[model samples]
Target: MTTKNLPIYQIDAFSDVLFAGNPAAVVPLSTWLPDDVLQKIAMENNLSETAFFVPVTAGNADFHIRWFTPTVEVPLCGHATLASAYVIFNQLGFEGDIVRLQSKSGILTARRYLGAIVLDFPKQPIVPETIADDVIAALGGDTPVETFGVASRDTDLVAVYDDATIVRSMTPDMSLLAKLADRGVIVTAPGDKTGLDMISRYFVPAIGINEDPVTGYMHCVVAPYWADKLGQDDVVGYQASARGGVVACKVVGDRVHLTGEAVLYLKGEITVSA
Candidate 1:
């Protein structure tokens, strides 16, 4: 097996501190790596997801990027996207403040806005639906006072709780959560403790994730739901996961804009075996 030095960086997105938000590994590569190699790197990093960026053109503005989890590849991921942007802008010595990423989903742009990185993402809207028994079981038997279903680029389950604390304090059965197929669950409520407008937690055990530390993809659905519920297009959301994260969100027509900060944790090199 041959080896090459691969640059990697660990970044905490949606948080200003070292360990608060989701930690993702960003690997900037010169060319596309083999699928097995990418998966193995993600598994070795053992983070929620790792991002790989390949330069589309030398010193050009855009690059092709892909994200992979230890188990599978994801279409879209917010924290890792943010982490990738942080690396391109701060570490790679790119001249421009804004960078464009061409992903499996589509083109995404990130820029520094209002002292934070604002990401413009496609909006996922929710329609009312009945809750499945398994969903209720996974939620620890606390029947949602109201349930709304949303299918955007991804499937989302939005369950409203009485308050934020209950959403935060929930202990779900991961075994039952594993039964859910290809859908992400969100338990959310109006915030009483935090200054934020609402708080929520995300679970995606079906895709081999028990609990996402900070979910930006879930926010795509959450922002629009609460925007209508709260009668305001702009909102502040707090993900109550153990690591926790904060997102400043706004609903703009059929799109949602999420803004937050990120901190780079580690920078190193990897030798990919060939």
Candidate 2:
């Protein structure tokens, strides 16, 4: 068994202030560990997502990234990716304006934009779908104005309500939701609050996450929808979880620009033998 003390960091993503955004754990490694060990670390951290990345020598990307939820490795995770970029830029002293993450979802890049980090992620293609009765029942019996299926690394369902107020007031039955989908369920609506174009709440009980405070990857799917609905390519969104956050979105062709801020929360080391 290999025993090592690995440096780790917890970061609050998609929020300028502490305690308002999603908190993700970041582990930077010189080499990749066994997949089971990585999953154990993520499970131990007990956060929504834990990101693992290693510096690469032969690729155009400076680093290769992976994301793990408690139960499985996810194809894409936005907040953790942002947290990883923050670590590379601030902690590792990365000199470049952009850090490209070679991930399972492909090359996801993060760059500085007006002092905030903007993540360039591919937009998920959305298709209109009818919500099942059980799915509607899972969401507190409030039938959404529209429902769509978004396909990417994971298949997710987006339920659009009439306004943000409805989104904020939701208290869905997570147990019932778990039976409906094997992925995420994003409930969203046009933003009712000032300086916000949309608001959303994410529930992913199927993947062991009940509610995500701020989901940047979700906007990659919903941003284009809102852009077309609002008749603008640039928009702002807020995730109305108990710990809220803001995400800046710009739809450009097949890709979506997801911009947000991340703040350092805690830095430490984990001693493990694998």
lDDT of each: 0.85, 0.90
Per-residue lDDT of candidate 1, residues 1-274 (tens digit): 6788989999999999998999999999888878999999998998888999888774433898899888889888999999998898889998876888888767787887766788877787777877788878778888788887776534567888876767988999887777763667888988766558888888888766788899788888788878888899998999999999989998999888899899978998888785
For candidate 1, give the lDDT of residue 178: 73
Query: Which candidate leads in lDDT?
Result: 2
What TM-scores do the predictions have?
0.93, 0.97
Q: What residue runs in model 2 are displaced by over 4 Å at the alpha carbon?
A: none
Residue pairs with backbone overlap in model 1 = none
Which sections of candidate 1 miss by over 4 Å? 58-61, 153-155
> Looking at model 1, how many pairs of residues clash?
0
| 177-250: candidate 2 lDDT, tens digit per residue | 88887788899999897899998999999888999888878888888999999999999988899999889899
Worst 10 residues of 1 by lDDT: 148-157
